[model samples]
Target: MVFFMNIRHLPSVFFLWLSISLLSLGGCAQWRPTTQDSVKPASTGDACEPGVINLNRVTGLSQIIPELKKARAVVVGESHTYYHHHLAQLEVIKRLAAENPHLAIGLEMFQQPFQPFLDEYIAGDMDETTLLEKTEYFKRWKYDYRLYAPILRYAREHRIPLIALNIDRDITTRAGEVGIGALNDRDKSHIPAHMDRDVPGYEERIHPIFDQHAGSSKRSFEHFMDVQLLWDEGMAERAAEYLNQHPESAMVILAGAGHVAYRTGIPARLQRRIPGKIVTILSSDGIKLEPGVSDYVMFPAEKQLPKAGMMGIFLEQKDQSVAAVGFSDESSGKQAGIKKGDRFDRINGRKIREIADIRLAMWNRKPGDVVDVTVLRKGKPISVKVTLK
Candidate 1:
């Protein structure tokens, strides 16, 4: 199983959940079906068939691409951890890149501030390791790098420009806590220049889900609203800016399903800024979506990455080094002479000074890989070799 730990305050969980129930009832999106089996025009009030799109089985890419190619921007949504969703995203990107001479990929996984490193990586001017470090991938978008490694590798190999399309988490966090009005000027600059605070049907749909959470007071809900808008608007602005600058180029956008569904989030916001067709595609992870949810819903086969290497020990961050605070059941570290309070000095010859450094060292490693770890045990350096599990 892949584990992801966010280092900063995360956006609202409800937004991440995508309010399937609300979307299922009365969401609206502009989508045309290329095949008779794809989608049929139905009443928006038809609750039985949301947006009138067939939601039963997977739709083939051949039937979907004709409509997708007509759009200036195509947004592909993922469930983040579900590896197959990423495969679906990559398939679309590969097809689109092959046809469009000038193609760019916009990623919600990367923050807007790190575009330079992404540019360098795709240009082959920087190595993968340096790109991960410089962009702070392990610290920010903390999903196992292996899940996204294939997409990143392909982008770099093909020299496709990758656009970073997210605001920093700190900015979103502060906005959620104190509202956007309280943010300082520098932080404000990172947000969208103009926000559509009252997006049609967005608040009404999201409010009920917001109320289900523990702290659903009106004021808290306002804060939640602020965070969601900031994420959608901020990312939309970045993508629009890029599209406006290079009007001839087409972009494949990779983002969470919540931001793509119903075209009310990033897709709608981006469309408002740029004059062109924008198509939204969602990969179904057994998610029952309504008709206007996206242009096409792909049913992809299941995919799983190889199990990540694990030391099987809990770590505590010390000032100079990371310490073993505890061990999991049947921990390999404990079996290999590692003890609680032993501070990590190095792993596989890479200096391990922080949690991020440890994650970097283990990024490409798989289960059963053995490595030498140096630890400071009682003022003496001790070397222990352990098999990762």
Candidate 2:
């Protein structure tokens, strides 16, 4: 997870805009694989080594699974926007699920309040669109659904339990604004019972990242640290609760690299609740790691998703419609005579009331595809044909 903590700068909107922005940016790390000693058993605490095993080779995966299977929980880290990272995550989940009949997948994307929606999706009670809408996925976890669709679909197909391992964003934002003690009972209910702020090396690890975006203010940094703790501890507690309830099952957790790397984030907090075997794997293009970063490091080749259609316009929700706030240099809508301040009424035949609606309308569209768009210009509806480019 790229920690772009630019919170103090944006006062008009809640902190969620910056949070979503950080998640939207692509992961920055590059991959440089180096050889080390032979693979060893996956061990946590003091016994873990700083070795990274390359999963590209056949033997690398074979050597790791035996050790991974022995663990009660397996954590896999990912760069949210990276297609290859998700592919590797799915591969790991599939491999682990093949052997463990009671395998469950825990997600950091969805909030705990929306777990029922996930359960409904897995139970075939609703379609993908309904699932996304009910969970407020586009509003909360703004990353492209295409990046995670395969894993979600696979879980649904196999009837695998998908655990939502995050608390509501509102609670975190409120906690950041007012200290944990200032929060009301409703917000406090969502927080973990134990928010261990004294985890060894956690603050030291977060300091460098915090310094980059936040100025030299001890108060701001402390607030930032508080928010980070809430994130890790909240997720860990949710995961632990599920595992405790279903001791017969094993879970594969998928979260950002920052939370899993060095075992200082979710993994350590989780260990506090249940001292069972836990293994972590990090997928990176190029991220340097010290000893005990993860049990295995997978080096996947650079892969790209097929280009989606581009409108080249900045959109925002205004009143009851989605408004075109600005246009990019090569905006297809601008070329089609669509002007700024025009509100999107519909794309093709689908209603466009929000930013997510636009994405849904154009999800499968390509650059060369021509789309008929209806926009409200000063309360009058006008139709325009845009050739996406």
Candidate 3:
């Protein structure tokens, strides 16, 4: 659940999400994976073209569906903010379902505590707002929900099992702040011992990145590594556990690309615990995707179009209205005088209560368009005009 950053960018990469506080505050940075950070490089391998797949003990590049069916678990990695990547993932799921209908989707976004919410949501017993709020989606995962809608819609339509496969963030944060020594007997119960399996390749890449950034640091790089492994192992263990419980079902595990890239994060850890065929697929995203980095790389063969535009504001359902919690300072929302803590009442004359409503309203809006917004500021309703940048 880490932000995908191209290390080649260096100091400029820090500008994407890194603030002065992030470099200074150790606990805040490691505890939350929301902010941008160094992405580990792929393990040793030669360069391969987009369509080719460097799979486990395989020879040459392979087609998507054929190779997907061959695995007991196919871990597809995603950058939470990348909307198109999730569409690519949905395409994979659609193709895989044709071969095996008894499919399960394991998620890294939702914590283990909210397994019931996922169950209920998948059962079609709850609404989207309830599901998001109950799972603490706003608190834990701040990415746009629209990016995940396709997968969720597919799962619900088919009534496929959705497995929640990560431990609570608080426990993971504790492991990152202090080593595993800080975990009490209760915390130990949440994660199994097998999560400590060797991922030497991951260590190779993450170590240098951590060292490069963590100059004169008080905390050890190994501590950060421990937290990541804790995350990887917990997810892998839970996925294995689900497979063990539902032997007939094969899974398409959705997680951050870092978790499965080069097979160092989850695939290897899961293999150490339970021996079975596992594969990874990730987005090329115009980056130099090294060979053997993943079983398959997904993107347009010719080119990738830039993502669509919108008012750069992070919203959450607040009481009867949607509240703004974050904003892209350079975006139009800032220029239009929309501030944090503003509760939405109307947008372009349509009542707005959820994020989907805003997306629907903005469907026809272009980059330089102005957005008419009404908000409740300081308990008084007010109107604000925002230009979408």
Q: Which is the leading candidate under TM-score?
A: 1
Instruction: Give the Å error, residue 124, model 2.
Output: 1.6
Lowest-scoring 10 consecutive residues by lDDT in candidate 1?
A: 10-19
- Which tens-of-lDDT digit does each residue in 54-141 have in candidate 1? 2222334654566667677998888999887887788888888878878899999999889999999998899888888898998888
State each model's CA lDDT, in order: 0.79, 0.77, 0.70
Clashing pairs in model 2? 30-285, 30-286, 31-285, 31-286, 50-291
Error of 1 at 350 (Å): 2.9
Candidate rank order under TM-score? 1, 2, 3
lDDT of 3 by residue, 1-389 (tens): 11223334322101111211122221222222111222443322422312222122211122346656867798888877777677767777887887888889999988898999999988999877668767877567666666787798899888888888887898888887787777899998888776554555787767666777645254667678778878898899999998888777789999988888767888887777665678777776633454346655554222233445678888898777799899876766766777888888888887887766665566546676777888878878788777667
Q: Return whichever of 1 and 2 wins on TM-score.
A: 1
Evaluate model 2: give its lDDT: 0.77
For every model shown, what is its TM-score relative to the native structure?
Answer: 0.84, 0.82, 0.67
Question: Tens digits of per-residue lDDT for model 2 on 169-213?
Answer: 888888777767788998887898778888777999899988898
RMSD versus native structure for model 2? 10.8
